[model samples]
Target: MGNDGGSIPDRRDLVRTKAKAEQADKANQTRARWFFCALSKRRLEEPIVACPLGRLFNKDALLEFLLDRASYGADGAAVAGHIRSLKDVKELKLTANPATKGKGKGRGEGENEETPKFVCPLTFKEMNGAQPFAYLAPCGCVFSLSGLKSLSSAKEKEPGKEGSTTPEKDEEQLELCPQCGAKYSKSTDIIPLNPSPDDESLLRARMEAKRAAEPKKSKKRKAADPESSDPPKKKKSSPTAAPTVNPNIAATSRAVVTSLALEEAKRKAGMSDAVKSLYGDPSKPKQKETFTTMGTFTRYA
Candidate 1:
């Protein structure tokens, strides 16, 4: 008959399964031990401690654990040391999550609510109470909201009380220039008033009399001097016979002859010496010899 019980596994398979389960259990216990150690020794100052078998353990489980410890009266140096130990364990990473770090109160907090006392505006230094006043702008003025309101009320009350006793002078303060409606300060420049309209005619007459008393400038001469004049003069007649050529015409003809003579001389100089010798002397006259041509009729012989 077939066996009623299922067949048992070989030793190797059984040992492998047992080893995996034990490893999982050991990992779970290690995590539990770390958590328990963190919670139990809340007041321990050591950042890392050795167990009996020489295994190292992190005194802090996470960054938040260290931060909470710091907030609840632990010294900053102690908290920082524990955080460094947790990083050495390799199970906890030392990193910044902008969401969890700083004054942020992590996931469950309301968005619009004010941050807790751990955050300060002036230095961003964590604190547990009202922060001290620190000036943050170039104006250098520092005052709480209540102080500013008191100053404004005092200024408004001062002008009214002082104006009633000197009504005439107060009216002048209200008389702003039409061009610039700003209130006149002590630094404003004041011009003297013009005379009243009743004396307008007298003022005009005095101005006219002043103008008549002033000397007038002399007029400048426009005509030329008579002695130094050089108008068209008549040429004197000569006792000798007048030249056939008018003097002006003769002068123009001489200029033309000079230019022609210079151009001919230049042309002769430009010729080769051999070619110039063939043409004979240019400055003196040369006799001309004529050559005659004969015409004849010829028959093919």
Candidate 2:
């Protein structure tokens, strides 16, 4: 089959490059991760927060996710199941990209509309999730690694204008942000953004250490007012008189009473004669009937 009307295979059909396919896949993944929020699937916005797994999310979206997990549907649980609270994420403080032309700023020339929102303030370089970027812990200002290194070198070479300030003092002292003038510990405060595995570990350890140094919250509760808390004394249920019994309601049946009396007599009958005489026998006892109704009988007669 010559390259006639029968078949005309294009370069794309002939060449199936594995490397190209892989690269495309990687680019797609990168765009998915860096350009959109992991939870909400919206365009990435600043005050961005990243989880331990390095998934980026908008701060508000993350807060929403944390507040109500069911809001984002089934994918919410799958994506943010690890994120129990805000503590699980690190809020990124981004530097404004100076090269980024605002609306109606640069309509002509080489202005890219899809430029990154945040960039290294020092280098004037776009972050774009590819470059090695870092932030000052104290001031939360961000800069490119190369820019920071260059700045650090320049600061080292520059002679201390004041007599008191020395090179050794500069090395030992805190790094002040050129943009914000915020002080940060040079050794510990420069945390790399979206760092590699090892760098992430170190950053996490530093974060934990910094948190440990902070004062712990008091667990003890404040005491309420004594007057408000104390309950009123209840009157000693004035020794309730043994619930008054109803005279009309017989406590025991007549037959039951008689049987009880007969049982008592039988018990007393078993006693010795001498003891019985001392205790007195009720059956043998006889006495004349006496009446105390003297006024009623005299009046009637």
lDDT of each structure?
0.35, 0.67
Question: Tens-digit lDDT track for model 2 on 131-205?
Answer: 777766666577888888888888777765633677677667887787789887777767766577788677667
| Steric overlap count per candidate | 0, 0
In angstroms, give how far residue 292 of model 1 lies from its true place: 99
User: Which runs in model 1 stand beyond 4 Å of their true positions?
Assistant: 1-6, 32-301
How well is each residue in 179-210 modelled by candidate 1, as lDDT tens digits?
22433321111211111244334434543453
TM-score between candidate 1 and the true structure:
0.16
Task: Point to the candidate with the largest TM-score.
Answer: 2
Clash number for candidate 2 = 0
Models 1 onward score TM values of 0.16, 0.53
